[model samples]
Target chain A: MPIPDHVLVVDDDPDIRTLVGRLLEKNGFRVSKVADGKGLQQLLEKSQPDLIVLDLMLPDEDGLVLCRNLRSRSNVPVIILSARGEDMDRIIGLEMGADDYLGKPFHPRELLARVKSVLRRARSLPGDVQEQDANATYRFAGWMLDVPTRQLYSPKSKKIFLSGGEFALLRVFLNHPNRVLSRDQLLDFSHGREIEPFDRTIDMQVSRLRRRLGDDPKKPSLIKTVRSSGYVLAVRVDRGGESHGSDDSGPGD
Target chain B: MGVEPDKIVVQIDEDLAEIAPGYLENRRNDLKHLPLALAEGDFYNLRILGHRMKGSGAGYGFDGISEIGRAIEEAAKQENRQGVEQGIADLAAYLDRLEVIYA
Candidate 1:
């Protein structure tokens, strides 16, 4: 028999945790519950869940930082839950690599839909992370992206330093190669917390990424900017390699 | 699902059996000590309790509990001393009268 997908929900409020737990269980997923970030880590040490439903206003640590940290290591799909439903909050949550975002006073049915949607997308690729890593190294435009370490290797074999925000944006673009990602879509994977409609923040990150990749902003070939819309990673990404299982799994509510 | 407040039945899911009892116990204890907070005029602490109740009650098949909790939280937030007292009284009266059944 196939194992039911496990969803670990991390929240400071026991009520919310339990409530979400009930909802997820009713939706045909195995559910584990935790009250704080600490509990989340402890659970991750035991096993990796299929997806994570994270709450932003944690008592111990900032959820966005936790999301970024999680992204730096794994491609685990995360759905952020926050009471702050402002556009800024949603953007920041997405920027932290949350695959999806929802606000409090949220409809339980909506959360279930997002849970299923993310799981479907994540599973569309090989359902196993180990299998993915075996051939998931994306190489494009003379740059090799090590998904596990989140390290960018230059043509000179030197490690390029990338801010958490920049790396997140780049990852989002890479995952959706050749696709025109709008500013709102860009916000889903960058680390900016401020909110504005199609602000220059994404542009700045793109410019920074171009410089790091040796792609000139004036004649950018790697990440091309489309007028009045968004940007696209124009190069084909190559993924072929032997794979290994990840020894670490991690986060909390 | 019935509005028979006297026969208020919280049909906690069987999966939550272990924790539901604890949740009820905790709320009972919280409600027990709430008078102390009210007498001390610690609206902040009172508000926190109400907030938890409001969020948890409906999630666990206890809409009535959540409604009372929301009222308490709102009163505390508004800092209306009279409203806070009335809310606390209402919560206490409900808890005192309602019966708990495990489904």
Candidate 2:
């Protein structure tokens, strides 16, 4: 029998850790549970997990810090589990290099599906095969997005890490820069879901993105906001190398 | 607008109500240090704690508490220490009212 893929779950709450660990284990993934970021770091040193399910409320450290640290070292996918159901937390979690964010009180089935989707995407890509083709690097406003490594580099060659949501949002914006996109349009493109018109979640996310880009909300140079409408990426985009994996691949590969 | 004189009772779960006072008190104490942090322009910690309190308060069904937390959060981001302090006071008042209602 083939060995199941390994998953590391880091949560401070014992009940949550156990619940999530059991849920993943029952879904055929070998699961390891840790109560804090320190334990998670130790586990990562000993064994490379196929995917990580991290909690944002670690007693020792913020999960976003750990996620960014882990991303700087490895391409391992990270899914953040947060009790904060607010859109800000989700947006920030995604902006911090997490592959996905699952709010607390989430259906176990949804968590399982997210894990499966993330694992499938991670495994789909061939490791250590860096494509040197022209389409490998995508450029926008002195920024370079490396498709295979899933890393963004600034004009000075400094790496700009993106959370899963930011990456997806950026991808959609790049695909249709200069076009005024409604929240619904952007949501559909990025998350494949229908959002309520009254939901300011998309607006909060755009504000977060603008902050990361250092674009002033008052005078956005890159992502312009249409009053009472949606957003439009004002910057010019230059597509470099083609992205690896299929177009239908799950995010944060 | 005067809040209802009769104790504004909510049918919160036993566990939630049991923990509500302590949580609110602890968060109120934490708010004291937030101003110092804000003065130093360290909004990250403020935002983090504010976001946490907002989530926890709402989860415990303290809608007023969560609203105050959100207000404090926005004020801190804007560097309005006075606004944050006012928010903290408002939260304390809300907590007092809640205590009376639950008492």
Candidate 3:
């Protein structure tokens, strides 16, 4: 028999953990539950689960932070569960690198469907991290990006942090610098799927990344807006280092 | 007061059987904490508990609980003692008659 996919569930509420665990197990998944980020980190150390279901409001560390840290090293898909069911919250969850976002009070069946869908998509897509050389650092426009540490430094050596979304977007820009990337292409390359209609997730993320890169919103120099098209990174990128993966899988870089 | 049903029969998915008992027990415990929190004017704790219930109840096949939880959370946010009391009473009534059947 083919092995069941292992799913790691991280939530402070024991009830939620147990409830989700039972639901997944009943659906033929190997489920492991953890209460907080510490437990999640401890578990990720031992085994790499096929996917992670993380709660937004964890006691030790917020799920967004955990997701950001996780994205630095692992490509395991994540689905965020949030009590705050606002659109902004969902957008933020996605920006933090969640593969999907479900509001609390959702039907277990809905979560199950999403889990199956996300897993299917993950398997079909060429693993993004695996495509890039592990520990590879990219430098462009007087800024250095360290993939392993997921850290960015300006020309003056001041460290500027990027969320997972911003980091992913920046990496895409670096990989294909000097070329105009349409919004559709950006979403596909960075986030892996087309969002709902009228959703400005890609635009918002680009704005945020530009702000992080100190590019003027009115007339950005680093990542310039193309009229009626998309955006382009107007710089030459220099690549360094080999594909040796980093062992620092702990939270916060 | 509206007419009260003798039993609130909740048909939960059989897949939830393993955790349903503990979930219901936690709600019963919430019933015990409501009055205590109200007495002490601990609206923050009340709001937190209410929010938690609002977020989880429907997921477990207790939409009524989620409704009451939303009411309590809003009342606590506004410091409305009467609304909160009403929510607590409603929760008590619901829990008093709640009957679970895993289908």
Rank order by lDDT, top first?
Answer: 3, 1, 2
Looking at model 3, the pairs that clash are A134-A243
Cα RMSD, model 2:
19.3
| DockQ scores of all models, one per candidate | 0.17, 0.04, 0.50
Candidate number that wins on DockQ, 1 or 3: 3
Better of 2 and 3 by DockQ: 3
Give the range of the ten consecutive residues with the poorest summed lDDT in model 2 chain B. Answer: B8-17
Docking class of 1: incorrect
Best by lDDT: 3
lDDT of all predictions: 0.72, 0.68, 0.82
lDDT, residue A71, candidate 1: 84
lDDT (Cα, tens digit) per residue for candidate 3, span B1-103: 4434698988998878878888989999998898899999999989988888888899999999889999999999999999999999999989889888899
DockQ (C-alpha) of model 2? 0.04
**Candidate 3: segments with Cα more than 4 A from true spot:** A127-130, A133-253, B1-5
**Taking chain A of candidate 3, what TM-score results?**
0.52
Instruction: Give the per-residue lDDT digits (tens) of candidate 1, residues A46-135.
Output: 877779999876778888888988888878899998655579989998888999998665656778899989976764443243334433
lDDT of 1 at A178: 60
Q: Which digits, one per residue and each the tens of the lDDT, describe model 2 over residues A1-253?
A: 2235789998765545655676677678899989998999899887878799988878899888999899888888999988666799889888888989987655567888999888656534422222222235667777777666768887788887776677667666666555556686677665532233354478877887777777787877777776566777766666664322212111110
Candidate 2: pairs in clash: A94-A163, A97-A163, A135-A240, A135-A241, A135-A242, A136-A241, A137-A241
